[model samples]
Target chain A: MRNTFRASMALVHTTLGLVTGWVLFAIALSGSLSVFRQEISLWARPELSVTPSDPLLVDLHALNWLSQHAGHAGAWYLTAANERSPAATALWPDAKGHYVQRMLDPSTGSPDGIRDTLGGEFFYRFHFELQLPYPWGRLLAGVAALALLVGLISGIIIHRRILADFFTFRLSRGQRSWLDLHNLLGVAALPFHLIISFTGAITLGTMLLPWTTLVLYPHDITASYADLNPALYSRPASGHPGHLAPLLPMLKEAELHFRGTGLEQIYVFNPSDRSSIVTVVAGNAHTVSTTSDVITFDGPSGKILKEHIERRPVIRAYIFLYGLHVARFAPAMTRWLYFLSGLALATVIGSGMHLWCLKRLRRPGHRGHRIVFRLNVGILAGTPLAFSAFFIGNRIFPATMPDRAFYEVACVFATWGITLLYALLRRSNHAWPELLGADAVACLSVALMGPLWHGGYITAVSMTALALSVSFTLGTLHTTRKVHT
Target chain B: MTWISLLFAQVAIGFLLFGSERGKRIFFEGQLTRERQNFLKFCGTTSLCFSLLLQLFAVREPVLDIIQWIMGIAIEIIVAALLCALWEKEHNRFFRAASQHLRK
Candidate 1:
């Protein structure tokens, strides 16, 4: 009975891994890149690469800019310049209710001529949203995470000699080697894998598992949000125009109230009217909680209207999980560590897919096997290539072109689509090396483009590109050698 | 400094854990006895615990420190494994020469 149970678990593990492994690889890889989202955004917009200045001083400039550009808007969100992101950002709702964002020079309140691009936010959002509309993308991501969790659990159940295999790795043994590596990487960082996956799932729990919210707030989901985050709740705008009070004092008061935590975001509601309220949110860099402690003030009076501190244990735990998954509170070194582990996780997923293909290759002439092999090559190799294309597009595209961000994203999908089509049409053995070699060249070009055009030898983006180039070059060499063998 | 110390500690743990048979043949040029293996395991575990404590003390934030320690260990393990795999002959020669020198 025990043996049967183990066999069933192994079957489930293999099935779950094979089914969700490709998507999980894409998600993990994007997420790993997203760890440096701010850095990547800085890379994309070279104008914002200046060293960070005092946010309080920058806020005055930002407010001046907003008064000219966004004063007539319904509401405004001003994010102060920080160590990670030096550019002051402002977002305001237009007449159409769509929020438009602009990057501002920290010193001069004018709009920085940064090219419109999705930037690193594409990866961060794509990790969870998958570029799909609304809750469906989140639900899909949550399901994929759930599958990953199940795969991990079942993988543990099947590995009888988990401890013995911890130090056992056999190189150049084909399928055996792949299995060994999959086990080694998986077991080495099992805690991180489990924590990241579980927390990721829980972070989307309200959307994925809506039963609890349904029970609590059957008629009104907005009410639930209001209860959880009362500061975000809006009051009707009064028609009477009122003179705005000085924001620096209210910001100072908020900084004092939050024990000197840096201000992350300032939200002004009904900014042009008498009932205007300003919300100052404390930054999350010092704590393992993504939900900022919020202090709201009356815009005209500058009186503290509401203070929302997340003190409930459950809510705090949820916030911690969210923070842990996002790693927004992490320092630079720790953030790099997170990025490395995320890459390791991505490797684990890729190797599992490779192992599956290797096993299928042992039995030739299977149509389904060939298709899986093609897909594995297309996705694993194609994603990095498409990402490189996106970066290249960012550099090459005209900065002032209309709807440029849309084209940037379109370039990514177009490259990815073309690569996938080529992979599916060509045989697996031919597809792998060609795509990998092309990806290597693409990466190398991106690395060189910085120095060639911008005259900077070692910007963060170029360094990242160089690293990726080396990695892809090695991958190309490995594939060529494997094919020759 | 903290990351460097954590990395060294992880490498030490990896070396001790793999000192027994497979890694010994590949990298160390010496076999470990069963008693020595047990001792190495204990030492590795203790070193890992010590590293975690050091990380906690260094960062002073429980959640962030724990994550940093885990990621640091993971990177160290990958590096150690890759080093062993890619430079096995070089490692073997170095260890063999060191052993000969020690004997002299």
Candidate 2:
């Protein structure tokens, strides 16, 4: 009976892993890159300055820009400049109710020299959205995360020698080597893997498991949001035209009161009205909780009407889990540690996919390895090729080109599609080295182009790109040698 | 201060791995007695606990510190394994795999 149970668990583990393996690998790899999202953004737009400027000046500039352009907008949202992102982000709803996001310079509201591109935001959105339309991508990512959780648990049941595996790794034994690595990387960081996967699922909690919200507020989702976060203050329009108070000083006051560097989010309801309210949310950098302090002001008077710091224990726990997913409050060393852990997770996913192909190819009467092998090369090796192309496009594209952001994303997909086609055409033995060699060259070109700025962020990005090039070169040589043998 | 904790943690893992049978066989000829293994493990355990306490006390944000410690340990283990592989030399699995490939 015990033997049967173990066998069933092994089957479950294998099936789950293979089913979601490719999508999980893409998500994991992109998510790992997303850890340095802000730095990547800085690298993409070389026109921006290195040293961060005053938050008050940026906030005022954003406010001025939005008031002139999107003044009568449904609402204006701004993220004030800070250490991670020097340029403030201004977002507002258009007449069509579609929101537009833009980054602005503090010196002048207009981005005079900076090019329009997704920057690190592309990876950030792709990890969750897969570049697909609406909730479908998020739904897919959520289900894959949940599947990963089950797969990890089932794998633990099958890999019974947990302790020995933690310290065991033998290279160059083909299938056995892959299995040992998969087990070692998985078991070595079991706690981290479990926490990261579980929290990934919970981050999309309302989407995956919405029964509670359904039962609680069956009629109104907006009302449910309100109930969930009473801290998110809002008010209705008075419908009378009124002059508004200056926004920068008001924002500074709120920042002072909140004890934070910059306001994370700003919501201006009923702009240009007498009853307008501007609410600001800033997460506490002092703790590992996503619980933010909110300050709502009377828009016309700029007087603080309401102040809310989350005190509810239940909300605190949920936000804590969310906090771990973002890792926004981490200091420099801890942030790098987060980056390394993310890479480790991505490796586990990639290696698992490769191991499945290896085991299948070795076994007699198994035919699926042929297609899986091609895909492993295409996505597993090809995605990095696509990333390199994106960086190259950012460097080469015209600065003032219209609809530049659209083309930047298109360049990525086109490069990725070409690699996929190449992988399908060639035999696996040749495809691996060829594509990895291409990836190496692409990375080298981006690095050799020179640092976008002399600032720490851009320099770090250049160094990282150079390191990736070296790693890819080594990979290409290794694959070539294996093929020759 | 954080580096101090990291140093201790690395030393702890280094001691623990040095005491293991595989580590000894790859570097030395035979395993030590059970008593010696226990002593090495005890020292490792003590060092690891001390590192954890030091990290907890040093950082302003204890949560971040604790996470860094856990993540640091994971990376160190992988590095240690790779170092062991490199030290395996020609008479071990590296050459064995090579010979097998040649025969095939």
Candidate 3:
């Protein structure tokens, strides 16, 4: 009976690991890169590499720019530059009802002339959104997370000698080595994998299971959100033109009210009207809560209006999980740990896929095995190459090109599609080394070109490029050795 | 300071585990008695628990602090394991050379 149970669990674990491993790898890889999203953004726009000023000074610059460019709009949203990001940014609805964003110089209070690109936001959004239509991408990601959770649980159940295997790793034994690596990586950081998957699922809980919200709110998610976060509730615009007071004093007051917590966002509702309201939301730097404590002010008078602090235990618990999933509050060392953990998880998935292929390859003339092997090679090796191509495109593309950001994204998919095509056409033994070698060359080119173009030897962009080059070079060498052996 | 201490503690735990009979037999040509094995296991567990406790007190927020500790410890373990693996390879090479010299 115990053997039967173990057999069933092994089957289940293998099936789920093979099925969802690719998707999980994509999610984990992109999510790991997104951990350094702000830094990547800074690297992308070289003009913004200057030292960040005080938050208040950055906020003032952003607000001044907004007043000059978007004062006639319905509302304005300003995000102050922080330690990680050097450019203060603003977003507002234009006359045609289209939302527009402008990157402001923190010191000059004017728009910076950096080239338009998606920057690191592509990976950040792709991690969950998957570049698909609304809700569906997030739903798919949630399902992937669920699959990962199941695989983790069943994997633990099937590994009979979990503790004994923890310290056992035998290299160069082919299948045995692969299995040992899979077990070691999966079991060593099992807790982190479990927490990350669970929180990731919960982060999209509302989107994945809208029935709960439907049953609770019945008709209005907006109202539900306002109910959950009272500070989001705002009165209708009075529609009478009124002179607005400066935001500096209100910001100071809100900071004091929040006990010196950094202010993250400033939202101005009905900016040109009498019923204007300015809301200041606290940053998520010191706590495990993504929900910001907010203080709203009467815009014209600059008087304190309403303050909303999270008090409910249930909401606080949700906030904690949300913060864990997003990891916006982590310090530098902790963030690096998260990145490394994510990379390890990605390796676990990749190794599982390889193991599945190995088990199938033992059978001769298996068409499905070849297809799976090719697809794995394409995806596992193609993604990093695609990322490098995207960065290269960002540099080579003209700064003034229309819809340049979209083209940057197009460049990524195009490179990825070509890689998949090449993988399908060529044999696995040849495709692996060639693609990895190309990736190494691409990464090294980026590193070498950064100094010539950006006039810097050790900037963040160059350093990242150099690191990626070394990694890809090592990957290429490993693949060559594996093929030769 | 917390991260440094956590690193040292985790590496110590890794060494203790790898120094036991089971790990040594797998990685190195060595053996240990039952008592010494049990002692090493106990020490590793106690040091791990104490390191976690130190992490808890290092940060103010409960959930974030726990998450930080988990990531920190996981990274340290990975590093320590890799280091042990390298050390095992070196030890095997050294012993192989000594045996060859004795035979000659």
Among these predictions, the greatest DockQ belongs to 2
In model 3, what are the clashing residue pairs, if there are any?
none
TM-score of each: 0.92, 0.94, 0.92
What is candidate 2's lDDT per residue for A383-418, written digit by digit as tens?
A: 888878888988888978987888888988999999
- In model 1, the Cα lDDT at residue A7 comes to 94
DockQ of 2: 0.51
Better of 2 and 3 by DockQ: 2
Candidate 1 structure quality by residue, lDDT tens digits, A1-485: 23699999988887888888988988898899899887777777765647667777787788777777777788889887777777777888888888777777888877657677777888999999888999888988998999899988998998998876666666667788888889889988898999989998998887778898889998988898889887664677889987569888988898888876678898888888898888888887587788658889998999988898778898888988898999888887877787878888888899999888888788857989888889888999999999899888988899888778789889989999999999999988888889989888998888876763453323656777788888888878887898898
User: Interface RMSD values for the candidates, listed in order?
Assistant: 2.1, 1.6, 2.1
Better of 2 and 3 by lDDT: 2
Angstrom error of the Cα, residue A91, model 1: value is 2.1
Query: Following a full C-alpha superposition, what root-mean-square deviation does model 3 have from the true structure?
Result: 2.9
Model 3 TM-score is: 0.92
For every model in order, the TM-score on chain A comes to 0.95, 0.94, 0.94
